[model samples]
Target: MVLHTVNCPPSHPALGQCLRLLAPGDALLLLGDGVYAALAGSRAAAELAASGAALHVLDVDARAAGVLERLADGVSVCDDEGFVALTERYPRQQAWY
Candidate 1:
């Protein structure tokens, strides 16, 4: 499955559109302002979890958003190395900035 990265906020329509295209086994990496989606009850968070895609939030971004401690159960927190690994593991990547 292709790996997708969304670094935009929930208010961005692109985030929703991107999530709708994801399927199980796909990956979504939330970075930049997108870490806000990691908030437990946010709509973006719910949609991400419901889609069954592997959800990942950048550690630095999550901390900057002050949501590192409030991320949902299934969201994985990743560092730069992990991000690099994701790029290596997935052949295709779609970035939603």
Candidate 2:
């Protein structure tokens, strides 16, 4: 399975393209401005919640973006260590900037 990292916002094509290509066993990480999608009650958050991929948000970025506390229920929070862990866990990675 692939680990997909999206560094753009939900309104960007990167997020939508990433979502469309995600496999059930893939993992998706939202970082940088992409963390905006983790906000609860958002249309993007709803779509993300329904996705089959494991969802994660970089906590540092979320905090930096000021959306840490407002993240959707199913979005897992992860630190830099966790970011490295995900990279190590998945042999292959795809990044969208």
TM-score of each: 0.96, 0.95
In order, the Cα lDDT scores of the candidates are 0.91, 0.91
lDDT of 2 by residue, 2-77 (tens): 9999999999998999878988889999999999998999998888878888999998899998889798887899
Clashing pairs in 1: none
Separate clash counts for every candidate? 0, 0
Worst 10 residues of 2 by lDDT: 44-53
Candidate 1's residue-wise lDDT over 35-95, tens digit each? Answer: 9988998887898889999999999989989989799889999999999999999989999
Candidate 1 to truth, TM = 0.96
Error of 1 at 78 (Å): 0.4
Candidate 1, superposed: residue stretches over 4 Å from native: none
RMSD of 1: 0.7
Candidate 1 Cα deviation (angstroms), residue 63: 0.5
